[model samples]
Target: MRCLWLLGGSYLAAVDSARLDLSQVAKDPTPLCHEDIVDETCELLSAGRNVFQRGPSGKARVLSFGELQGALHTTLDSLASYMDFIDLDPHRAGPFMVNCMELCSLTVASLPLTHRPPAPDVACYTSDAGVVCDIDVSDASFSNISFDTANADGTNKFEHSTAVKVTVEMGNDTVWSPDVAPVDPEDRDDMPENVGLDQLRISVANLFRIFPPFELEVTESKNLDDVSDPQIVEENGTDAREVEVAIEVSPTHSPTDIVGSGDELELDLSDHEQDDAAVGAGTGEVASKRKRRASTDGEDSPTKRSSGSVTEAAVTAAELRSLLGEHLREIKMAWGDIQDRVTAVEKVTQGHKKELKVVHGKTKVLDQQMTAVKAKGDATARKAEDLETKLEGLTSKIEELGIKNQATGDGSDPWGEYLARRKEGQPGRSEGGEERKSLSEEDQRSLILGGWLADTKRSIIESEAQQILDMPALANFVDTNRVVVFGPRKSFGILRFKIRDGETAAGVKARMWEVVNHVRQNKQTLSSTTGLGDEGRPMWASFLKTPEARKKSAMCSMTRRVAMRLAAGVKTKEGAYYNEDATTVAGYDVDWSTGTVWSGTHKLASASHRKDISRNDDYQALKLGWVDIRAVVAVTGCDWSEAHEAFQHEQ
Candidate 1:
């Protein structure tokens, strides 16, 4: 009947043989609001009581008990509605839903998350046999992926990899549960060289299961054997195998407790022993058999035999703790894997980098040669230009002299032939400006430059260029596994823990100190010399060192008016505090009770705010500069004596 209802619940179950991964479908894209809403509700509810208990001041003002209580109920109701809305079965529903939802919600709200957390997904699988199985999620999937790999001994095989999923009407709604991934033949990489064949055995055991009664029909009027034949070939010409899937119904989880998807199949002989004991109690069978068999095959109190199921409440706590422990282990394992993979990539990358470096060295040599060749060519051209210029001048003068003599009707000496011969010999002129020419000096310069270039090229070849005075030798090393976490220290004016390869204090101290100082100064300026909460004097003088002014134990209108006349301070009273001018002191204000003594105004809120910021005599808070711990550490090399000494004297 239950199976029939499961089939009749809805058509969604029978629609198709999708082998759906309901885990993907049930994924919560939003952070679980469970914890956040609960926390917020609790805090808001408690806020009024806390303020009422402590004499309302600071952020405690405006808190009301009635509103907080009402808000809490509202949050719980909203959460309850959500719990009811998820389609889960009645056999597996209750406080656990509330708890799980609350946790999910709280985690989402408190953290600045960019993506939604993973939710329970459901998937079902069917074998050649008609037997249907149902799997319910009990813990986080990422925490421990039960890989379907077997050691050679055939132990630790996580079967049930491929499972289809569908939403069945649990009791509340048609909510989907977590499912498994399809069997990927290649997801398991090749085993290490040393691993035995047994260790590398990859086999599917039982990744997931589907309930009986096909929702829709993949094998209608056809048996498992009939549908086993290959229908079509895949891209690789391998037969495309398909199977009918159905929505799961049986083996539901106790939503409040540990719900294991695996089996514990040990047989109990205690019942047989108990029956024998009963017979002995009636017929004295134990007395007759007390010799040898009774000692070896013993019965441990027949009354102690367990016949009922485990309680929901008992299992919930244990499983929750187990879940947390598993989460931490996963983090460590994932980190190890990441470190290992990165180390491998680094090696390959380094090899490529080395190749590039060698190529770069070759390029540098070639560049030097090119530079030298260019210089030689430039010098040779310059030399030719100079020689041509000199030759042209000499030739022009000779031509003029010859023309002048001819005009005077004197001897035609035929000097042009001699001039041409002299020009050629001079090595500057080239065919009387018919073409270009080179100067001898320029040619000499080219040869000198070329020689220098050659020498520069030689320097790069025979020896490496100069490095640092005594540079450390470069070497290759890899740490591809675990990461070491360092201790916490003051970094950038904030208390920070150093993770392995995490941010360094040295890098951020300067900027962090600047912000801290700025905020501290502003705090001092706002609290001082005013007839605010100081009442003319500070309550804490041991920690603060502020300037002087008269203060009053009891505030009066005259004191408030006179304080305005007497000192400088900010008038930052909020709307709620308007009835009572409850603005606090910042600078040194006079304390009539102490008769005008000095004070120190420290304001480390995490410690004690009043103790840090109050003056005993004067009602003023004093501001002071601070030396950054990280910078001090860097400069001083080791001892924190300087910072500790300052902190000690700060009072």
Candidate 2:
């Protein structure tokens, strides 16, 4: 039965109407060709020959579809076995097989016809899309095209005179169709039989006019899958047998056309071998092995062919040379790819080095900042230590000053004494028996400066004092000298002198009132001054109003001996006696009218009769005198009758 073929959306008769015997087709090494469809198959053969021609006077003869199909089926079976070995998807195998058959058919159908066939070396390989075949056609008539440079249109221009190497590629998901125009049905009846043949040849030739060979079929949908199982049809409402017709066409680049380095090629081979081992284990079949054709006297041994059982014609010397040349081109491409990979790796290394340098710089900056912070911390610690030392010294100096004030009788509470004098209406009098006058502002300032200088052991000078007064912080408080003078004096001598004159009580009162009013006027200035901080300077009113000061002011003043006696609750005068010149008398009589004491009719000498009473004995005698008794009575504010009764009882 004649096999039908689809081309350009139409069914076409193959090379012969008679059925091809499978047995004869398989046994025959040379392909059978017929005159009627020679143009169609030769048209495809010419396109492959254009890119690669072998030997001088290179030519190709017509091939029958049966022989072409058988060879392609063998290649397809080998590819399927390899795909199975590599564990590819089972669904893709059917489509991939169909696509490979169609692509091979298109290639074989594009060659020029000749009487004598040129021997070509053919090899098939697995590609990303499917299988690809490389046919050595280096002897074809039009294989001398060269590309020296690209044209202005961004296309590589060809010159037919020089020998050049070229590659053609067809992308995935693309469609292709013959460029034949529609024949006019009316004109077809009058047209010569050869005229239609000539038109077909021209249409096939037009397909290869552009570089890279294949043309895109823009009108067809890209999602078409002609390899799917065909739908069944019913005849007379009865179910007919299921009929499946599938033909798929796809494009791909040759092995030389795939640009890559030797490393990538090796990686691809390793991946294939690994997959082959896996699938082979599952299927219980040994993975295929590569066979290197040993050269004997520079000729490919006839025995060393592919592992497939299909018989092929003996390879000629020219075909062997062509295969070697193809291998050489592959080596050159791999070297170029390796160089490109090396350059890219170097660029990445440089980028990493620059990043490391940046990190190092940042680390150094951080280190420097840490060092500065450490230094600041150390300086702060030293300052704190110095402050602690100064505080200790001030504490010791204050203790020493306290001891000295107590010894010199200046430690007595002057604030209490001043309050007492006010209550008694005894304002202080100077040595001249006149009331002391308040000092002028200049004299007060001078006194304050002199006192401070003496306390600090610094030389007192008018210029220095005026300079201190002229300071911006102190300028406004220049007239407030009374407040400073009344404050706790550091010098015991000055404090003693002030206490003796008793001029500080009224002055302190008046100065305190003035300070209160001044503070009110300068509240903002005083509060804002940096020297005073948030609370401002202490006022005399607040200081003197403390609990200790108030408690001291409330207490009554008495001599130490009288206070001791009162505290002991001694109401009787049992210890009253008179002692003089180492002689002691137990009984004493006080002559209240004459202010004299008599001891057993012997007149006791009073303390005032001695010229020096600094001795302890003289001091004791002074306490025994009637004068001291009268003075105690006056100080205690007791009635004279009670005092006389106490003395009379003692007598």
Which digits, one per residue and each the tens of the lDDT, describe model 1 over residues 290-312? 10111122422212223231210
Worst 10 residues of 2 by lDDT: 262-271
Which candidate number maximizes TM-score?
Answer: 2
230 Cα displacement, candidate 2 (Å) = 33
As a whole number from 0 to 100, the lDDT of residue 330 in candidate 2 is 36
Please give, for residues 1-651, the per-residue lDDT of candidate 2 as tens digits: 011211111121111112234355346533323322344333333323322222243433332222222222223444344334334443442323222223323434443332112222221222234332222222231122111133334333323223334332223222221112333434332111121222232222222220121222212212222212133212212111112222221222122111211111111111112212111101112212221212223422223334242322233333433443344333333333443465579779999999999999999999999999999998997676566546655664465456436645865665576678768877633214443344522233222222222242111222233443354654443342222222222221110112113434456445434434543444422211234335533211222223332222222111222322322332336653222211222234443323344434433334223323343331222233422334334333344455444444432
Model 1 lDDT, residue 277, Cα: 14
**Candidate 1 residue runs with Cα over 4 Å from true position:** 1-379, 382-651
RMSD of 2: 30.6
**lDDT, each prediction:** 0.28, 0.31
> What is residue 615's positional error in candidate 2, in angstroms?
73
Q: Candidate 1: minimum summed lDDT over ten consecutive residues — where?
A: 200-209
Off by over 4 Å in 2: 1-247, 252-254, 258-379, 382-513, 525-651
